[model samples]
Structure formats: C-alpha cells, structure tokens
Target: MRIADIYKGNTPVLSLEVFPPKPGYSLKSVFRTLDGLSDLNPSFVSVTYASQGESTDRTVEIASRVRDEYGCESLAHMTCISHSKEEVASVLDNLEDRGVGNILALRGDIPADFSDDKRDYHFASELIAEIAARNNFCVGAAAYPEGHIESKRISLDLDNLKRKVDAGAEFLITQLFFDNRIFYDFMERARYRKIDVPLVPGIMPILNYKQIKRILMMCEVSIPAKLLNMFDKFSHDPGDLAKAGVDYAIKQVSELVEEGVEGIHLYTMNRVPQVREIVFRSGLREKT
Candidate 1:
C-alpha cells in the first residue's frame, strides 16, 4: 500500500523505521526484531537502504519479508549517493518486482573521500525526478524541521523540499526532533511555501546517553535544555535513563497527535521494547 493512502483517512497513522543489518551482521537478528515489532501493528514499516553491495541486497530481501512474511506494508528506502543512474533504476525495478509499493528517496551522505564531480546524482530532488519519471512507486522524501545539518538556512531547505515535491514526491517524513514547537513552526513555513503534502513527524526515543549524543552530533539536531538536564541527572543509571527517554517520547508523541498531525514515524533503532512502550504509553496503539 502507498504510505500516502494510509494517511487519507481521519485516524492518525503510526509507522516504524527499521534499517537493514550492516555489512558483516547477520540477518537473523533483524528478522527477529521485525517479528517483535509486528505485534505493535504499525501502519507500515520502512526499511532503510545501505550503499554497500551485500547490504543493498539485504535491504530488498528484508523489505520483501516485511510485507510477505509479516503481512505488513513496507516502504523500501533508496539512496542515490555513490550510485549510477542505472544502479538506481535496477534497485527500483527490484522493488517493484518484489511487490513493495512505496519508497523513500534520499541523497545519502557522501564519504569524505568521495568527490562530487564523479557523482551521477547529487541532490535528492534529482533522484525524485528520476523516480517520478518511472511513475510506478509512491515516493516519500525527508524533511528537516530544524534545517538540515548541511543547509545554510531553513528557507533554503524548504525551497529544496519544494523542488522535490514538484519533481513528484507524494509525501514527506521529517528527521527526528525533540521539540514539538519546532515541528509546528516548520509546518507553518511549509504551508506558506505551498508544499502541501502530508508531513509525518519522525520520533526517536533516546535510549542511551552516549548513543544519542553521537547521533545528535551526526544529524546536527539540537538537544533541548530540558532533555539535556534529564540526561545529566540520569546519565549514570541506564535503567532510569531508558525509562526517562520513553517518557519523553510519549510526551512528544502525545502532543503531536493532539495537534492533528497526519502521521507519526518512529525511528525504532531496532529496539522493539522501547518502541512498544512508547506506543502503548502514548495511546498510539489505541488509536491505530
């Protein structure tokens, strides 16, 4: 099913994002994680893409399993970085053949050693244009509520987003955010710009201090002072920190839902227990 269709109804949609195992990891553990998450009854699950050769195969394999074996709709992610036009087409063809109906188009991070002059695709808008030409997939693109790390200004970011939509993105899912106010402000800007597709807010419950710090730094997401203080006070206690993280996510989600946002996507990080707790506590399970 197209993720955009899932948002057509009045009931709020709840989704999960899971990544394929890295190069040397076993697929067994990832399948196990999917098995555990299936019980939460996500509106759909999105499988992230990997640029590595073997892991790329696993990306489609697991996404097909999510729909075929687990009886859930799947959105397969495809990134254009470090790929030729033919390579991107082949991946899309594979996804269509496997019965996966949705895609999240991305211009993934470029390695420090890679040069842009040698790249076939540089921006996500270019990739979205290629996908649009195929006219066979429901496409989703990423949005940054707090301007993207690489972007100089949020206005520029929204302008780029408009280009993606014009190129044929059906819907959008935002990067993980800690503050609801930021998301609300982003929506206003997006609407004013006339980029009016369903914008689903992405949420990631911070389970550990070290892990979250690393991710926040990489994504260039600002940590709220309140959340920073919580981490400082409970950094020494893993159990307490985990509980606090779940609570914080629940609070964030609850407010988003109350605001009548179109959908919510959880960056599960392959941790079923934390996601399950947030869904149940935030009353998402009841609505979905």
Candidate 2:
C-alpha cells in the first residue's frame, strides 16, 4: 500500500525508518533489528539510500526484505542530487523489480569530493517531478519544521516545499525535531501556503549525547533549552542518558499522538529495544 493511504486509516500511522548496513558490514545485525521490531507492528518500514551509492543495493534489498520477509510495507529513499537522470531511472527500475513502490525523493547533500556543476537534478522538486511523471510509484518528500539549512528564512523553506508538493509529492515526513510547537507552527504555515498533504512528524530518540549534539549542529535543528539541559546533566553518564532518552521520547510521542497528528515516524537508528519501548510507552501500540 502507498504510505499516503496508511495515514487515511482510522488508527494513527506508526512507522519506523532504518538505514542499510554500511559497506563491508554483514546484514545480520540489521535483520536482527527488524526481527526485534516486528512485534511492534510498524505501519511501514522505510530504508534510507546512501547518496554515494555505497549502500544503494543494500537499501533496495532491505526494503524488499521488509516487505517479502517481514510482512510490512516498505519505503525506499532516493537521493537524486548526486545521480544522473539515467541513474535515477535505473534505480527506479530496480526498486520496481524488487516490488517496492513508495519513494522518498530528496536532493542529497553534495559530496565534498564532487563539485556542484556536474549534477543532473539540482533540487528535490525537480526529482519529484520526474518521479511523478513516471506515475508508477508513490512519492514522498522531506520537510523541515524549523527551516531548511540552505534556506535563509522559514518562508523560503516553505516556498521550496510548496514546489515539491506541486511537483507531485503525495505526502511529507519532516526532519527529526525536539520541539512539537515548532512542528505545529510549521504545519499551519504550510497549510496556509496551500501545501495540504499529510505531514508526518519524525522523532529520533537521543541515544547518544555527543552524536545528537553533532547532528543538531549540522542540521541546524533547534534544541529546546530544557532538552539541552537534560543532555548536559546526563552527558557523562551513558546508562542514565539512554534511560533519559527513552523517557523523553515517550513523552514527546505521547504529546504528538494526543494532538491527533496523522502519523508518527520514528528514526530507529537500527536500535530495536529502545524503539520498541518508546512505541509501547507512548501508547502508539500495545505490549501485546
């Protein structure tokens, strides 16, 4: 089923995002994570593609397995900035052969090793348009609740987002954010701009203090002052920090669901236990 259709169901959509195992690593671990999460009944499992193509095959394979082996709908991420138009078409063909139908089109970050002038698709909206023209798969796009890093202002970010929607994005999944208020505000702004597709909030549990801090720095995602404080208090204590991360995510997801958000997307980071805990504790799913 298209991920967009899942949101229209009576129950809230519960989804998890996972990445392909890195180059030179065995797939055993990631499959284990899937096994651990199977009982959670994720409405769908999305596999992220590597822009550099190091794990592209693995991404397709994993997404296929998530459907064929795990009995869950799967979404495969496609990064077009680093790929030629032919390359994108080739990938689309491969995904179709694997029976994967949903795609999250994105203009990936430019690699430091490559110059910008050589790419075929310059923006995600362009790629979204291309995929939409195919009419074979359901396409989703990424959104930033606070604002995109490349955009100078939130209004500009929303403008780019509107282009993606107009180009044929069926739904949107936002980047991970700590503040729910910011996401709500962004939702209102996007709706006012006439981009009325379902907006799924992405939530990542703060598993590692340093890693989360570095991500916030790179993505420019705002860190609520209180969350920053909690990180500081637990920075030196790994065990305590993990516990705190779960607790915080439970509360965060609980609040989002309470607000009647159409869907909640969890960034699993390939860790199943904590994600399982968050789903049950957040009341998105039961312990059964």
Candidate 3:
C-alpha cells in the first residue's frame, strides 16, 4: 500500500521504521526483529538506505523481503547525497521491479570514503523531481519539526520543504521528536509556508538513557523537562526505564490524537513490545 493511502484512510494509523545491518553484521538478527513486528499489522514499515560508504544494495534487498516474504508494505529509503542521476534512477527502477510501492526520499550523509567522481546529487528535491517524472510508487520525504540540524535556519528549511513538495512529494514523515508542542508548531509553520502535504509525526519511545542521548547528539532534538524527570527516576532499571518510556509515549500519542494530528510513526527500534504497548494504550486498536 502507498503511504499516502495509509494516511488518507479512515482510522488513526501507526507505523514503524527499521534499518538494515551494516556490512559485516549478519542479517539473521535483523530479519528476526522485522518478523517479530510483522504480527503487529503496521500501517507500513520503512527500511533505511545507508550513506555513501555503506552498502545500500543490501538495504533494498531487505525491503523487498519485508514485502514479499512477510506480507507487509515496505517503504525503501532513497538518498541523493553521493549518487548520480543515473544511479538514483536505476535504484528506483529496481525497487519498482521488486513490487515495492513506496519510497522515502532523503539527502543522505556524505561518507568519509567519498571520492570526487563518486558524488553527484546533493538535495532531496532533485530526487523528488526525478521520481515525479514516473508514477511507479508513492513518494515520501522527511521533515524536521524542530528544523533540520544542517539548516542555517528553520525558515530556509521550510522553503526547501516546499520545493520538495512542489517537485512531487506525496507525503512527509517528520524527524523524531519527544515534544508534541514542537510538532504542532511545525505544522502551523508549514501551513504558513504553504506546505499542505499530510505530515506524520515521528514518535520515538526512548527505551534507554544512552539511546536518548545518542539520538539528541545525532538529530539535535530537545528533551523536555517532564520527560527528563521520568528518565532520572528510572534510568538505572532497564525494566522500569522501558515502562516509563512506553507510558510516556502513550501520553504523547494520546495528546497528539486529541489535537487531531495526522498520524503516529513509531521509531520502534525493531522492538515489538514497545510498538505493541503504544498501539494498545493509545486507544487506537480499539477504535480500529
């Protein structure tokens, strides 16, 4: 199913994201994690594309497995940071041939191994324009609720996002955020900026203290005081920490739904229990 169709469906939707293993690591564990989550009936699952130096062929292979073997719709991440127009087109054609129907276009990181001749495309808008020329799949793009870390300013990022949409992005999945208020503010700003695509709020259930810090370091998201206090109380207990995290995520989703936000995209970390608890407690399964 296309992500746009999922968002346009009647009931509130829940989705998950997963990343394929690095070059040396075995894919057995990764596939196990995805298979475990398959029973949850995710609206769709996303498989991330690696940066330039990494192996993206494996990523696309796994995405195809998720759809063909497990009966789940898959969204393959496509990046432009180090790929040429020809390379990007070839990858898109490969995905379409494999029966994958959705794509999450991105501007991936520039890996240290990049050589002068290897680098080509820069912005995600370039890829979006290329995808628009074909009707093979439903296209999705990333949005930063608090603003992209690389952006000079949020206003500039919004303008860039509008261009991506105008080029033919069907929907947007935001970078993960803990605070719903920031996402709400982003939605209003996007409206002012005339970005009218359906925006799905990315929600991450912080399962560990170290994980939270890693994400903050990587993405430049802010941690609210209330959530910090929860972490302070349960940081030592892995079990308690997980409980607090899921409880907190449930509260976040409840409030976001009350505010009538579009959808909740869970960065499930390939953990089914967290995803299950969030879906169950958010009162969505009952409604569905």
Every candidate's lDDT:
0.89, 0.91, 0.84
Best-fitting candidate, measured by lDDT? 2
Between candidates 1 and 2, which one is better according to TM-score? 2
Question: What's the ranking of the predictions by TM-score, best on top?
Answer: 2, 1, 3
User: In each prediction, how many residue pairs overlap at the backbone (N, C-alpha, C within less than 3 A)?
Assistant: 0, 0, 0
Give the best candidate by TM-score. 2
Return whichever of 1 and 2 wins on lDDT.
Answer: 2
- For 164-246, candidate 1 gives per-residue lDDT tens digits of 99998989999999999999999999999999999999999989888998999889888899998998889999989999999
Candidate 2 per-residue lDDT over residues 140-218, each given as its tens digit: 9999998888889999999999999999999999999998999999999999999989999999999988888788887
RMSD of 3: 2.1
Give model 2 RMSD, 1 decimal.
0.9
Between which residue pairs do clashes occur in model 3? Answer: none
Clashing residue pairs in candidate 2, if any? none
In model 1, pairs of residues that clash are none
Q: Could you give the C-alpha RMSD of every candidate to the true structure, in order shown?
A: 1.5, 0.9, 2.1
